[model samples]
Target: MTDATTRGFIGQLAQGDRQALLSEGVEQIFPARSALCAQGEIGTRVMLILRGTAKVGRTLSDGSHTVLGLCGPGDIVGEASAVAGEGSARLAAVIAVDSVTCRVLAASRFRQVLRARPEIYRTLVAVTNDRLRRTADNGVRQAAHPVACRTARMLKELAARYGRPAPQGLLIGLALSQHDLALLVGASRESVVRALSRLRTSGIITTSRRKIIIRDPDGLGRAGEHH
Candidate 1:
């Protein structure tokens, strides 16, 4: 799992452990906007991302989709269902945000690896716990904070995790639309647009072609604080 607070699973593994895990899988490439995995389907394999980014989300009963998290290089997807034994339904859908390369492993093989490598299993458990905690925290923040505050906090997080230094400011490497941000923040697209406009007008951030540049990180942090 990839998140602002937690490093991806492959990055956390020892070099030997990492190599061992990758050796079991076959490399596959997915194009941008492709579905890596679908929710509610039986999971047969898990994917370890080697390059690019993916978005995890679940569709609601009312036909709306909620963004769960973002996955980048070194992250693993569909592991939860793979770990849940045979015929386990996937809890979320993962789609390629950009061209993605992954090492794909069958569920049985993954389980076999876990049985042989207790250390790896422990590490996966830790990562899962961290993801769950972050999800819970986001839920609480959504209920307690204003949309603008939450949006700012999310931007700061993206910058901290995936940002690269640019001439203008810290550029978030992920290509995200206003609707994607809205889904991630659990707000209406209109509300997210207003929040982003405010950030732009105040000279805290700038956006062009789905790329966001944080001009004043400290100012963004201040804006994220509860008002």
Candidate 2:
């Protein structure tokens, strides 16, 4: 068995499993903000992200949305619908947060791949469990943590998962708006603004034009510990 990683589906598979999976899909590129899948729509395929990040979320009846998670390189999307059988509807929407490249396999082909490799079934179970675990953790943080702590923890999480070196500091790869950040942390937009301002004032982070740079990741992490 391969080591577990946030890289998602294909990442859990061994070389042989990976190759066999790739053989079933065609690569496609999507620009930032493109919707890869939308809630309530019948899924016809599954996507394996090869590069960049995608946001997974569901739209509410009030026109608001909740961000469930982010998907980056090696993550798979739409698998649940595929596993439910063809013509199954999506439970959420997945949109590219940056320019993305992905391998898309038609539903019929994906089902075939599942049956052909029993090992893949095991891998699928593992990946699905990891995703569920993350969702549970996020819920706990939102319900129990204060907004400042939640915001700080969110920065730490993003930096750990997607940070890239920059002259200024470690740039978080996602270009998240304050509203989007609010959605992720389950805080009000005003509260998120205040939290970010506090972080900036403390010299733990800096933000500009939708980009957030972590100036002191250690400090930011510590902030998350506060009630």
Candidate 3:
């Protein structure tokens, strides 16, 4: 399979299986800043993102929120809890970062489909394992890296996953505030702002409003490695 085909839940599916899965769910639109799934709630359904972006995160014991990851088109959210069976609490919150379209399936029905399609189920398991591995890597980076290095690595990741070619550089498709970056990298907002400023000053990136463009990806990568 191509890299794209193996990356996300929907992408991993065969054409017929993709259509069959979507046919079993209802389409729903979630507005920006709304919660698609809240942490700690007993999840009843899973959502397959059809368009736009969402932030997957959780509130800590001290009531501070940390961003776990970002999900965009073709990604699946809430499947872990949904597959864990009826009474399992959601492990994270999925909030719409922009207006998002999703295919929503009841947990029970989702499980039924999985049971009937072993291949699809296996693909889902692989996707889940990949996510877990990335999460663990992010944890290790947070513990070892400086804010600037972590910020550079995070921007590199975002650019690879969601960037599009533009006149200036690769424009990150997702709109993100500095606060979002801070939460994602486990740094203070002020520290993230400083890191961004350093990157901007170095001509490695440019930002306007909530948009960011990578002007010098090679330089950014070097910064991530050196610091």
Candidate 4:
């Protein structure tokens, strides 16, 4: 199954298995804001998200924060830490973006499952590789491209991810606040505002409240072109 199907179907299978597993060590947690991995915690655990979102960020010198990325439902967190033992939490914190439903899989059982079903392991590797590639590509874009270009590119990517066909074209459901938009585009909130207004004036996009309607998909695509 692809990312879309894998995320959609597995949630439906063995409807009761998730609940049963939740009670036996492989439990669920709806952590409050700013939840760091517990001290002296075992590294052999997997977090399967059922809903909501979290920020994976590492602390920096001088007390500033740099977000590694945002993760949501169907994402598996704790992989890096789970893989590398005898280390402090590699990630500084996993803060709840909203209330989240998650199942914890014991590290040992996770490995056993993988050993028994090597095919799943192969798929996991492929998924991880693709994600890593995208992350590297995004970092390069942030470093090399102008914010206007990056913002346009990110909008198109998000549209493809969450968009549905509409008479107007693709309706991107990204209701990102200025700060959030800035984070993705690597721009100041003021720059985001200016770029968005300029795009609107140019007939490339239309924004209503938080929703963005792409009036000219090709134009928007060009605006976000990396090269």
Candidate 5:
């Protein structure tokens, strides 16, 4: 298996395995925005997010977007539906955050690969479980907490999940703007700004450009949780 920063792929195989899949008709697709692939469509491939971010969400009759989840690099964009074989395109659109390069795996070819790599089933299950838990947890916070508290909780969670520990505490990769923070925590942009201002004034958080420096993390947690 080749170690890709985001998605896992089988690579460096013997010449035979490489030739086997090449004959099975796997193609790459570069889809643009507002592209609607309906449910029960004959799905020919699974997509792995190699770059950029996409929203895996459903559409309402009002034509509004209810973001079911977010997919970033290293994420499996579609597999469950592919596994089932017959279902509507449960996910509506995967709009390009920038540009995306998806390594498409045809269903028949994918099944053959899976037979050779039975362990992939376990890996897929584990990944699905993790994503499910994350979505459930995010739902609870968005429903239960106010914006400021939600933002704090999200930052703490993000720090633990994706951020690397700095000597000072934890540095979240992006210096998230108030707007992004609002979207993440399901709060109004103005509210996120107020909360961030409060956090700054309290000296519990600091920022350098797009990175969030969580100063006094415990204190920040206490402040957010208590309020």
Candidate 6:
């Protein structure tokens, strides 16, 4: 069994167990704006994020991009692609939102590890299911909520999942632009701008450059729950 101290999609495993998984993989670093893989591009590897943030999204017919979700440390990218067997292409593009470090595992080698450790395979299944549930939840929220509410919900989730303390309040450590927020919320840039304006006026949040500080988390949570 693995210890509880190791947190991630794969859960905590002994050092030897972790090394066993990484034995067949190579570590690499990606700078911000680097693309790990693009939708429809044939791929042969999966990446396990060791540090930093990444954005998973797809390009639309109009050439605009929609952010599906944010992937932070301990997240996996290109898992589906790797599972698609030989000659499979990506379903979405994974881009480094910030400098990222990850372990790149070849499809065959990844399967080898899973075959050697059934527990790891079971953990992967659980993680994949959880990700699906979260994606579905996000879809429902995006479809049912107003822009302001959705924006607040998104920010709240980000802050809870990846925030750090700041003098103002909780700072979402990820460098997300208004455009990125709009994409995540399925809103227009102008709509997001207006929503942010309202939040700032209400003292729920404050922004400087690309950084956002949540001054009132309780109020923000209320906004998200208001429907």
Off by over 4 Å in 3: 1-7
Candidate 4 matches the true fold with a TM-score of 0.72
TM-score of each: 0.89, 0.84, 0.89, 0.72, 0.67, 0.84
Report the number of the highest-lDDT candidate: 1
Which lDDT tens digits does candidate 3 get at residues 40-124? 9999998988877799988999998778988877788889998999899998899999899899999999999999988889889
Which of the two, 3 or 4, has more TM-score? 3
Error of 6 at 35 (Å): 1.2
Instruction: Please give the lDDT score at residue 186 for candidate 3.
Output: 88
Return whichever of 1 and 2 wins on lDDT: 1
User: Stretches of candidate 2 above 4 Å error?
Assistant: 1-6, 61-64, 166-169
Residue 85 displacement (Å), model 1: 1.3
Runs of candidate 4 with Cα error greater than 4 angstroms are 1-44, 85-88, 162-175, 200-217
Q: How many angstroms is residue 19 displaced in model 3 relative to the true structure, after the best TM-score fit? A: 2.4
lDDT by residue (55-75, candidate 1, tens digit) is 999999999877899887777
lDDT measured at residue 170 in model 2 versus the true structure, 0 to 100: 94
Better-scoring candidate (lDDT), 1 or 5: 1
User: What is the lDDT of every predicted structure here?
Assistant: 0.88, 0.85, 0.87, 0.63, 0.60, 0.81
- Lowest lDDT sum, 10 consecutive residues, model 3, at 1-10
Error of 3 at 143 (Å): 1.6
Whole-model lDDT, candidate 6? 0.81
Clashing pairs in 2: none
- In order, what is each prediction's RMSD in angstroms? 3.0, 3.4, 2.8, 4.9, 5.6, 3.4
Candidate 4 overall lDDT versus native: 0.63
| lDDT for 170 (candidate 6) | 89
Q: In each prediction, how many residue pairs overlap at the backbone (N, C-alpha, C within less than 3 A)?
A: 0, 0, 0, 1, 8, 0
In model 4, what lDDT does residue 122 have? 60
Ranking by lDDT: 1, 3, 2, 6, 4, 5
